[model samples]
Target chain A: MREQFDIPEGVIYLDGNSLGAPPKHVAERVQEVVKHQWGNRLIRSWSEGWWEAPQRIGDRIGRLIGAAPGQVVVGDSTSVNVYKALMGAVKGTERTEIVCDESTFPTDGYIAQSVGELTGLKVRAARPSSLDLTEDTAVVLLNHVDYRTGALHDMKALTEQAHDVGTQVVWDLCHSAGVYPTQLDEIGVDYAVGCTYKFLNGGPGSPAFIYVPKHKQATFENPLSGWNGHRAPFAMEASYEPDPGIARARVGTPDILSMLALDAALDVWDGVDMKAHWARGMTLTSLFRSYIEQMTSLEVITPNTLPRGHQISVRCENPAGVMAELIARGVIGDHRPPDILRFGIAPLYIGEQEVKRAAEILAEIVN
Target chain B: MREQFDIPEGVIYLDGNSLGAPPKHVAERVQEVVKHQWGNRLIRSWSEGWWEAPQRIGDRIGRLIGAAPGQVVVGDSTSVNVYKALMGAVKGTERTEIVCDESTFPTDGYIAQSVGELTGLKVRAARPSSLDLTEDTAVVLLNHVDYRTGALHDMKALTEQAHDVGTQVVWDLCHSAGVYPTQLDEIGVDYAVGCTYKFLNGGPGSPAFIYVPKHKQATFENPLSGWNGHRAPFAMEASYEPDPGIARARVGTPDILSMLALDAALDVWDGVDMKAHWARGMTLTSLFRSYIEQMTSLEVITPNTLPRGHQISVRCENPAGVMAELIARGVIGDHRPPDILRFGIAPLYIGEQEVKRAAEILAEIVN
Candidate 1:
């Protein structure tokens, strides 16, 4: 990497998949918001660019994921935005079947379930390996990458298949967007959502983004519609009239401080090539896999030949114990339930040397 | 008055109703989080302390509002929390009539209408002054202070009235909570929501606070049930199980930086008596009203006899023009459409002296 981040040293930190290391420039940006914009400018800050942050950041993120400007907005959490996207899909369709994978992040499925329960639709789950779009399915929801296994889904093919069956798709790109050149537009993604705390590294619990294809913006009215989404928010009007663009997806006031932090994080991504980044990440993971696969009883859960994203996982007898022990040994990946330790290979910070060292440490532990 | 804020020397700020000035200590707090907690701690910050900020800062706010330790939480915007509180209220009641004031903040009415439209219920716009609580009402939502008029509603009496009709009550405490001793339990409020940016001085667009009376926590669930609300969020389980107590109101990852700023803001309020705070605000507002009513065409829109909140508005033929002119002259207040310039008397940093001087300056413009 050309520029250094504020990521911790002396530990092989692999949990950027959970919370990305803070950018070095975020402090100066937050200082500007706290000092000049809010302290001195005060209410004028609303007019001075505060009001447009959701759409502005959304557009910046849109460039990475192939979404057009005005078709995406950055605000709220990933789960909340998924609710909006799923509700938009369900309300627009005549059928009531919403389909997803049983092994995807449970919140995505749980939120889909909540949307169905609250709005009177049926939520169905299938194993990711066999999730074929049925004729009765009005909408399909899927995580672009599995959190436990780092398994990449076939976004373009699955979306096309679902569309052919007359079902709209809502992709949870929480893991896929930051590390890859996601062709969401080329794949005809109807709606999508993702978090910033991951590879995009806005910070822990940072605001997430949502993308609705420009073709669907006018017709899609996902219904947590608050005043910020009002056509004229300052009018103090009584009725809920949504703005014409993707700004309508905004549910409440943008968290200005966190938005500034996320914006600064994007500065690190300005001129990066996604292809090179993902290759660098996968190369490091491959070396680690070779060093440890036969050394221990750990079974690599991630598909070896398929197009997996950067992070790799190993299924073990006691994954949480291994993860905790690794952390105690100064290697920081995460544990997912019964038997998966997800080691995130973030090329932005982690390099070849660190990956080799972490592999040696893990091999020692298992032995 | 002796300590100089980072505000511009010539500016007489009166728009705290929309967005509060940053505390002098916030910049330091932001630096610490961005550099040490987020940058240094990285992902472990969640386990280290970041995850508890919403509740920890919430308890600090509870002290100001006379709430018990576990009733309050800080996250999301005020409008979204209004939706969560309303959904929680409806879930507690089987019959689905939501009775609310049309005069409440437009966000409150919007949420009621949204719940009606999204979940298939009857949302009635009750004439708040009529005190007519009908038999079928499931919930009554009211702003403790009218946003435009600053007319304070009798929280205790109204909540009692709603209870008599077998209806739960939700309080929109945005305008009243921080400025006054908001004894939510004393008023028997089942659920309440408020913003921190105004009288609490938590910077612009800060995260808001939601109060779910511990007694009612078991009867309902937050509508935006994202994973953060799950009892075992890290388990990767496939079911929708909510965390017990008030934590269930939390739907997604919190904005830790924003919540931290709010925490620093609450630090300034540690020794404050909220009743005394309100007395000072009303006293200063009374001075402005007494002065503005004496000269030229300024007509006070807010009733003095009623227990008003922080803000006081006055009428003029071209209020927006005058407001713009006032901004030029460095006295900051907002003008509503048609005829009102709203002067919010924030007692945390304002008192009788500034109020008297501001009124004198206003009278000069009128004359």
Candidate 2:
């Protein structure tokens, strides 16, 4: 599996959580899609393959996330999908408050705020564990994996608590999906949105996927109701009639080129053992944390015993300077502003050896 | 310029208005972007070039559309951009109606309807000539070129009229942008949204561009205010504070792959004369209309005396069958149901010879 991605030589890339290294097969697949499917077939390719790409690729992503068929459709950016999911979850509800956390990704929080502003709902920010869900709570937006600290929230427990208070839950799985398995359907999550550019190893800014359980699909009203979501998009009707099921989640023309790149990148997970993959990620992160603790004066911010995702974060005095030095030494990680140095341990292409090399370099730079 | 495209041999592609043929440079550019920039550079590529692609490519597109340097930024699908532009235009206005026409693209009307539904405004659909704009009209969404008829609207006259009634105007430049010269700033348009895939020869479903005038940029409030539009996106702020200029029009991480393809596609227009391009387009479309009128019994629905864009539509019996036969004979055009065969003449790659060949095939198939 390590051979599947095109990680550059002499560079220990630990920034897979920001932008996953492109898969080795993506170049050839994109070439075929660009030259043969698009250049040769021209407009006819829309019907032949392009039209169904969102749903088709969505199904593959759904399989990885433990979602049922027809419940996931891939399109738009994660931020846009976050808006749609939040809107769909809150519509038709008398509840007027959207419950979110301060630690969620900036875009997710901004989208929640925008949704609140648009719909006249109150956006309530609370700690993840202390979300005081009440009858006024329309939607609970939570991230499965913390983008800064790699803290993993218990989705099932949080969703149950939200449901106890009659609040729908929408999960932002940007740092979690494809890093590990998610039982969204089993957990009864009302809506979920995730990006492919990170742990999924889709090319940069590839389209994101949204999950809407089967029961919610028929009545889910995406606010960005574009013609592609129509029951018969080719009919050219002036009126907006959303297609039934997850297809209605689609808002515009599918980015065929990037979508195909993601489709090719997803081939790496065809028969992947996701549970084993998650375990390997844990092992690598734990080893990196131990090495850093033993060798450097930096403090690990990610909780050691808590359920976490594939990344680890450490606190340093000057993260920007340290990160610049690490990159100069061919160890590529990122610094989330202020003082956090984050390293992502992607199990597919990244292994224990890469993790050890990265830790060694970080220790040298920090000391 | 015809030699700059990778049109399939033996096919007279007359559907550039539907989906422009892929540029010869696109495949190579996409490969380099995928394998080198994304695969090797990974997260660093965002800082290297990916972060500015939307605005950079948008400035290139702005040059062709007669917009100022900082007035345009590209991201999102055309439908999504339509929603953003309409939302930005209608916000804070006391006017209650969104004026549009039946000839607008279905997605445009649907987006207008969605906007009306979201904002509690009435969507008034009427003929372009009888828009009936009053002080009550908040925003008027008009297509510069009729999608079905190829009739070009007088942007200057209509925009001035809308302004006279105190209505903001949003132009859908899908059919006009790359096909001819558009003086968006000179016309005093408030907002403009257009797709790059059609005449611009961007790959299928390439991200769309939105233009907001320099003066209007400060007050334009796109409802889908994601974090990318933030003043400091990397700051991880919880509140939504939009960035100052046209950069605020960007909603999310750009589709870098498609953006790069569009960037390469736009290179075909570099240093080329837009006036000359429009003249060649007019000449080719004129020849096509004359050839079809002379050789076939089909009625040319596209007006000859009226100003037109790149495409010409003809009304004929059994258009679906005729189009299928024509396609089999290597004359590639599209049929809009209830009997219209649409032919697009893109002067960038299409010429008078291809137009004549398509007309001959249409005559053979129809007769």
Candidate 3:
């Protein structure tokens, strides 16, 4: 159905993992918000709809991610949301260890280090293979999928292990949100944060979302409580009394222009089946792996038989150069440091032929 | 002249202090970015223009605030920046006190409480008359201008006293930046945070500015250390090493759309002297004060002295009702609790005629 949408010609977009390509209707949405809501409605839009974008959109994202209504609020960058989630997760807990993987994204590690350094708590972030879950762990912070390696974490098992030790777990869902199925509610994860750009296709710099399970929503303390999160924002209270809903996580007035893009972008996901999305991912990734392995002496860092997210990572001896070559050949993907080339498969706007051709292009380039 | 710029008509645009009216050029700027920088350039925009917005516009804002060029960086909302500044201020210090005012905006107090409740530090906040500026204080956060009452703090004395006690001072410039003149450098204030939407007239949710003086630049730590803050954001370093200058304060890629509005809005300030801005503020506040005093038995909450910020606050019997009435009558301002009406005066755009007519409208309704 998204064939009706327009993506630029000759551009093979694989960098959705970094910043999603613009949604079809984002331009119209931006124009409307700038001309009407801001130009005409002015400040009254706060009362009209300007104020509730965070909660309204949060609930919409919650529907996709297995969260109930009123348990997710969108605002800030994903990293900031990570900071707030970790800070709130650690609050009032006697546990001293904030467990995470050392291979985590720098922001997550930085957040863990920041929380630990400022709070004097110990952040014991080891490789998952070497991790020891203990009662002293306050929380576990992990990406649902590794950004560079594209390795998936078993949410249910890790969450259960953390919970069995009386430790809370906060999940970063940046790469897993739209292309894969998640059982956040079923897994009983404590908190989650993610950006919309990767798979959700919220355009660049779109606001990020935070999920606090209904059980944790009422108790979460958003460390960055700007006036927007006030119980009665217009009441102008001096003390911070959070709104009882997921809206409590909002830190400031959202960028409505960027925000409306997310809403418009989500419209594309209305009828698509997610399994079909994952199948497309696996098919493309498998083609990519098999083709590159046969065509050239390339090392695929993405695991062969492990559960994976919607991306493939291969190690070329000159990944950056090969990536530039791939881009020149009209196949767009990104290269991480140390010879890792990453490609994300998103089916909403991606077609099977594109994947086949992309693999063929990789094969030719490698040869 | 700013008068050449057109604001939409017939709306008594009072909430410039909440979310500033858009600069006339912002729509076109947004159009340019949406169609060109993003739709066309796509990811290349990051390496070209998008990545530099945080420090680039920060320096623009620093020019207005009398900060040196390398001392300010823009990113995060005021609250997140508050957490970063406050957290960074207290690390490795012997001081145990984090001082604030109870009447400070919840974001300010909330962050101080966060530092204490998250970290093991002790927090000391005071009401107006009882605040303690003591030796044990690691940092003192005071609103340069009170959000509710339009009250101003004595930056020189406070910063000097804090320095005398080996403590740092963090100024929340939300109510002060682009309103009138305040010599933060002249006052030796160690660090400051200010939003863009208020008097600076960036659009809603503009990235806030953080000022770390040139002297303190070497020791500053960005507690919110996302990839953007790393010394080589593109290098993708394994360990975090912050950029040497104000770039150390950047945490995330800024919203370029919002950053552009602030960039253009600073044009509203060029060549217009701040001395004239301050003098006009006094005149406007005095006129509005006289008008409010002439008719109503309402109390004036803003201090009537040389040191206060440029806004005027008049107490009403029922603030919400009065604010509604004022809005209906087209006199734009904000109402704070129990019963306080506050108006911010930006002399570059607001003049004696606007203030006098605004007072007459208030007098006609309140009487």
Candidate 4:
């Protein structure tokens, strides 16, 4: 699996949680899309395959996230999709409040705040475990895994709690989609949005995905209803009637060049099993954490009681300076503001040896 | 400029109105970005220019649209940007209506309807000329050029009219941005959104641009407020505070691959004057229209009383069949539903000979 990525020589990249490294063949495939499909075939390429790439590639992502075929469609940034999902959740309901995880990725919190303002719902912040769900709660936005702490939240339990209160759940899967086996279908998550550029290795800022299950498809009102989502997009109709399927999640013209790049990138996951892949990720993180605890005085901030995510974060003094020193020595990790250093263990391309070496380098810098 | 694009060997690509021909150098530039920048550098590429790409590429596009630097920021689909611009316009106003052009490109109309629904503003459709200007109108959404017909609207006059009624105006420049010299700064247009993939030749489904002039920047309230628009995006602040300038329009992580391709495509417009470029488009359309009128019984639907846009639309029976037959002969124009056949004369890659050849072929097929 490590042979599948174009990892730079002598560089121990532990930032897959921030931006995954590129797959070895994505560059060649993207070039072919640029030269042959876009350059030569031009507009005819849209009908040829480009028009359906969103749903097609979305199914590829769906396989990993436990969404059945036609349940996911990819396009737009996660922020835009967050807005759509939150807005779509409260459509005909009389609920007047949106409950959001207090510690969420800023974009999700900000987008949820905006949705609350637009729909006249008050947004309240609370821990996922203690959401204080009520019948008046229109929707709850939760991050499957905390971005800063790498603590995995129990999606199934939280969703059931919200459902018990007759409220929908919108999960921000940015940190968990490819890292963890998020069974969106089994959990019956109302809506989910995730970025491909992180654990999926779909280049920088590749478009995000929106999971709109079959049950929610008919009633899903996409607020940013672009022509592409219309029943007959080519008909150029004035009235907006959404497609009666997963494609209602689509908003506007897809970013094709990036989308095709992502389609190619997904080929790397073809024969990989999510459960086994995530198990290997745990092994690698466990090994790395053991070395860090033994060699450094820094405190691991990633909660041990909770199921861990793909990354491990450690609290240390002058963490940005420590990360800069570590990167200078070829150990690539990112630092959150103030005092936390984060390292991600990507099961596909990253292996035991690389994670061990990264921990050793980090221990040297912190000491 | 024709040589700068990889126009297919035997196709008269008149569908630049729908999707522009890919620039030849864009393939190589994107390949390098995928290979060297993303593959080798990985997350390091964010600081190595990826982070600032939306605003940087936006400033280059601003040069063509008569906006200075620090005004236009590019990302998201035109549908998403329409929501931002419209919602940004009616922030502190007490107006209760949003006036949209009845014949707008469907995405603009659909997005306007959604925005009106969310903001509690009633959406009313009217011709740009006959819009009932009133103090109650919050914002007027107008297309600089009609998508179905190639009629250009008067921005200066309509903007002045909307201003007199204390209503802000949002212009949709999908059909006119790169072909006509849209003086957004000079006209003091309240807000505007445009597609990059059309006359800009920014590849298929390239991200769209949003223009928020200096004055509007202070008062513009981006409803889809993602953290990327935050004053300190990297700070990961919980409360949303928009950046003081055009960056406030940015909502989320940019689509870097498509955006870089657009940045490379904009190089084709380096020394070309928009005024002279639009003059040539008019000349080409005139020559094509004259040939079609002389040889075929098609009714040119683009009004002669109004200023023409880059394309020429002709109404004929079974227009889709006629367009298919025309495409079969390698003349690639598109049909808009029941009647209209649209041909776009992109001055950069299209010229006198290709336009003439396309017209002669269309005449033969129609007759």
TM for candidate 2 is 0.99
For each candidate, what is the lDDT? 0.83, 0.90, 0.77, 0.90
lDDT of 2 by residue, A198-294 (tens): 9998889999999999998888998999988999998888798999878999988988999999999999989988888898899999999999999
Task: State each candidate's clash count.
Answer: 0, 0, 0, 0
Candidate 4: residue pairs that collide: none
Per-residue C-alpha lDDT of model 3 across residues B1-367, encoded as one tens digit per residue: 4463444665555566776666667777777777677766677688787888777888888777888678888877888778778988987788778888777877778667767765578887776455676777888888888888777777787777778878888999998888757787888888899888788877667778899888887899878877778888777765678888888888765666666656766776777677777777788788778876886667788888876777888877787887888888777777777677878776555666777778778777777
Residues A287-319, model 3: lDDT tens digits: 767766776677778887657877778877788
> Which residue pairs show backbone clashes in model 1?
none
lDDT for model 2? 0.90
**How do these models rank on DockQ, best leading?**
4, 2, 1, 3
Tell the DockQ for candidate 2: 0.85
lDDT string for model 1 (B29-91, tens) is 888999998888777788888887888888888888878898888988888898888887786
Per-residue CA lDDT of model 1 for A144-234, tens digit only, reads 9988888898888888888898889899888887787888888889999999889888987889999988788888886787888888887
Candidate 1 to truth, TM: 0.97
Regions more than 4 Å wrong, model 4: none
Give the candidates in order of TM-score, highest first: 2, 4, 1, 3
DockQ of 3: 0.49
Model 1 regions lying over 4 Å from their true place: A294-297, B1-5, B92-96
TM-score of chain A of each: 0.96, 0.99, 0.96, 0.98
Worst 10 residues of 2 chain A by lDDT: A358-367
Clashing pairs in 2: none
